[model samples]
Target: MTTLFFDLDGTVSNNFQGISRCLNFALEQLGLRQLTDLEVLPFVGPPFRESLPRAFPGIDTEAALKLYRERYATSGWLENSLYDGMAHAISTLHSQGFAIALCTSKPRVFAERIIEHFDLAPYFKGVHGPELDGKFDRKTELLAHLVEHYKVAPENALMIGDRDKDVEAALHVGAHSLGVLWGFGSRKELLEAGAKHIVDRPDELVHTIASIA
Candidate 1:
């Protein structure tokens, strides 16, 4: 069976509400200009360490991260909703015997909490993510760590996510990638990132993963 690695934020849950809230809170704390939710949309897929610096030039990345984490750890994490049909899709995948796991840029502690909150823990065999200290912050490094720890061959894994980084990370690790359209990324971005497959809906995930497998 192919090991299916799923991204957490945009792929499974629409975390924009929480992410934007935390982001704006940090910006406000730092006296930076606050951006609208739309302006904050593009930064949802990547890690804050990378996205924050891009979103606000000359901002103290560490300070902003600290502020963001404070709110996120409190109530911001609950400001999320699973994408419609995501729970069903993941459940179906699990029943079909796919070795499913979560591979996300979010910290493991937060990711696990969110997964449990959504009742998704039963479907995932593992929840892989970076630590609070910035280790495995890069997709490539995260995927590599998952591959090593799980002893899954990279070629037999399929990465499914809503961003270019997900596809690029799979490519770097010699795994196939599937991009979902219901998330934050565009078809062009996924294609440009070398995604092997693209599915427009959560309902399409099962068939798409089967095809890739």
Candidate 2:
């Protein structure tokens, strides 16, 4: 059976609106000017501090990190909702014998909530997410830990995500990568990062994976 690790935010959830709202809210509270959607959208995949600096240039990294977490935990994170057709795709993959799991940058506590909220618990064998600290900050490190934890060989595993981070993560661990265009990222970005394949929609995902194998 093929093992698949999926990123949570853009890939499984259509919660970008909530994320944007919360980010701006945090900025507002910090007395900083609010960011436009396009500006905030880039924050969706990268670390909060990295995004915040771009949004609030020359801002203190420590304070920015603190406020980012505070806002997300208090409001932004909970506003998330799973994307349409995700449940069906997950169910179909499970029934078809794929080993699916979540490999995300979001913290584990909220990751668990998102999974349970969507009633997607059964579809995933495990959930691995990067810590808020720098320890597991990169996708490469997170993917490596998940691979070791699950005891799945790199060749038998695939990482599915919406951004270059996901593709980069898979490649770092010698796993295949599947990038999705339906999410926040563009095909140009994924292709540039050397994604093995790309899926335009949820239903097409299964076929894409099979063809890759």
Candidate 3:
């Protein structure tokens, strides 16, 4: 079975709600306006340092990041939940002998905490995120690290996620990406980002991988 690298946040955890809330909260604290759901989506998949400046352009970058992280780490990220059937989908893939890895831009401490909190640590072989000083921005760079760390062959690796970033990351690693429509990003965005396949449900990913395999 091929190794599957999945994105967290908007992909599996539906954690964009927390991120959206935190971004809005941070903007509010900065005396700015809250973004609409459509407006907030572009911010979901990428790192905060990158997304924040885009969402709240005039705000103090440092303070905005600080507040966003503080709020999100405290409760915003946790406020989110998983997509239905995600656990089952993961279990089925695992039972079928697929190796699962999490490649996300969330902070390491918070990523670990979220996985543990969600009781999902056992399903994955590895989980990775950003380091201190918050330097990771591009999906291509993160994907390269994941590919090396997982020792994944591009042909045997698939990235499953809900955003364009996930697709970009997969492409960067030379892995095929299957975009899930139920989470954060729109179909157009996914396609524009070069996602060739789309799965409407979690279990559909099984077929997606099988077809690729």
Show how many residue pairs clash in every candidate, following the order shown: 0, 0, 0
Residue 103 in model 2: shift from native, Å?
A: 0.7
**Model 1: residue 48 alpha-carbon error in angstroms:** 1.6
- Return the TM-score for each candidate structure: 0.97, 0.92, 0.92
Off by over 4 Å in 3: none
Ranking of models by lDDT: 1, 2, 3
TM-score of 2: 0.92
Worst 10 residues of 1 by lDDT: 47-56
Looking at candidate 3, the ten consecutive residues that score lowest on lDDT are: 131-140
Candidate 1 Cα misplacement greater than 4 A, ranges: none
Measured on C-alpha atoms, candidate 1 has an lDDT of 0.91
Please, what's the RMSD in Å of model 2?
Answer: 1.7
Q: How would you encode candidate 2's per-residue C-alpha lDDT over 10-47 as one tens digit per residue?
A: 89987687778877776777788888888877888877
List the candidate numbers ranked by TM-score, top first.
1, 2, 3
Relative to the unseen true structure, what is the C-alpha lDDT of residue 64 in candidate 1, on a scale of 0 to 100? 91
RMSD of 3: 1.7
Best by TM-score: 1
